[model samples]
Target: MITDPQGTVLALFLIFCRIGGCVMAMPGFSSARIPMQIRLFMAAALSLAILPVLWDTVYPTVHTSSATYIGFIFSELLIGLMYGMLARLYTLGLQFAASIIGMMIGYSQPGAADIFEDAPESSLSGFITFAGMMILFMMDFHHIVFRALVDSYTAMPFGGVMQMRATLISFTDTLSSTTYIMLRLCSPFLIYGLMFNVAIGFINKLAPQMPVYFISAPYLLLGGLFLFYFSVAALVSQFGQSFASVFIGR
Candidate 1:
């Protein structure tokens, strides 16, 4: 019984390499707020669950040699990272766009520690990022991620070639798609900021003696906040829809 214990362990280890890499890079799951121990456990548990389903595809292809095994592990890790990074890139765009919106609307008064990320983000930026991530979780986004992880073996096959060119293309496409979506999400704020600022400029030109910068800053901040209050539902809803399309379709 268990005549090939070493092979079984090695097979599981290889599976862990890929799943662990994906877990460590995926958004929300990878957030600093989540303990590393939890993430490692999640990856290990996921690998165990997926191993049997992929046993024939993976176990046969695995090698016992230490050097060959190491190579396979790295390659598998790379593929997982590519898949995980695709989603991370999409969410990161929202964070970036939030910052742009805050700055454009004169709301970047101060920065606060982000609940998920290590960087200091404007309060609104941090809020939007957290809300979007929460909405994603409620939508069961991780189920899709894990489903794709399982399917990746079929798409790329176990120990298949890494197709560096296609990976590069994927990376580029994620970046471009992220930029386009973020721009669309924040365009309203951009327009509001521009029109409001221009009107303020005209007022300043008419009454140069009055302290426009001081006078207008409060109004600018107030208007942006008011607009955000009314528009946040639409913004969050549209963002969630777009995220689902990109995450699932990509």
Candidate 2:
């Protein structure tokens, strides 16, 4: 059994392992733009907050060897990483959807540049990725993530069985959901793209020298942008709802 200060410290370390791992892998908190000091501060704060509540359940005994302690730390880190990956995957869904939309609208240039980050995403892809991240912040999705972390202590107490398989299943399920939503989100663009291309094809067949491809470019872009602007609200709402449904297991 764990003793006074020994158990408390051990619990703190374990919880910090998971929290730190999450901070390292999550989006807003894990972004390269965020300072390391801020991330560490948040991790420390969260670990301190959870130490008391989880100590009795998760705290390993001080009598254990250093290797055992290391093992416990690894366990905590794994759990945190799993959760963090889920969040990151959700963010990627927006990028994937944007890529699809870009392709449909003839904007799927492979090497376009952007200022927000190092990635060289197409314009529409970049816009979608930026918008999704913004929506997460605007919707207070981070708070919900924190809440989930807190609740995790209850559902998956420290030192409890990690349920690795179940976690993997959850991760895969999130991936599938993300893919499905992304496809659905870009369905309108896909349809429009098909029709536009078919029409352009017919026109080209009639007047082979009319520069149809060149002229159609501007119309395609304007139409895609207009549709995206109108659909922004719906897209954000669907993502938030999907997030809750998956993370909260609803």
> Each model's TM-score, in the order given?
0.95, 0.87
Candidate 2 per-residue C-alpha lDDT over 180-246 given as tens digits, one digit per residue, 9 for 90 to 100: 8778878988998999899989999999989998899989988877887898778867876677666
What tens-digit string does per-residue lDDT give for candidate 1 at 1-250?
6667878888998899888888888999999989999999999999999888988887886665778778898999998898889889988998988988898778866778988978888889988888888888887878888888888888777777788998898788778888998898899889999998899899998988998889888888888889888887887777777866776566
Q: What is the overall TM-score of model 1 with all chains considered together?
A: 0.95
Q: What is the lDDT of residue 106 in candidate 2?
A: 76
Error of 2 at 3 (Å): 8.4
lDDT of 1 at 94: 86
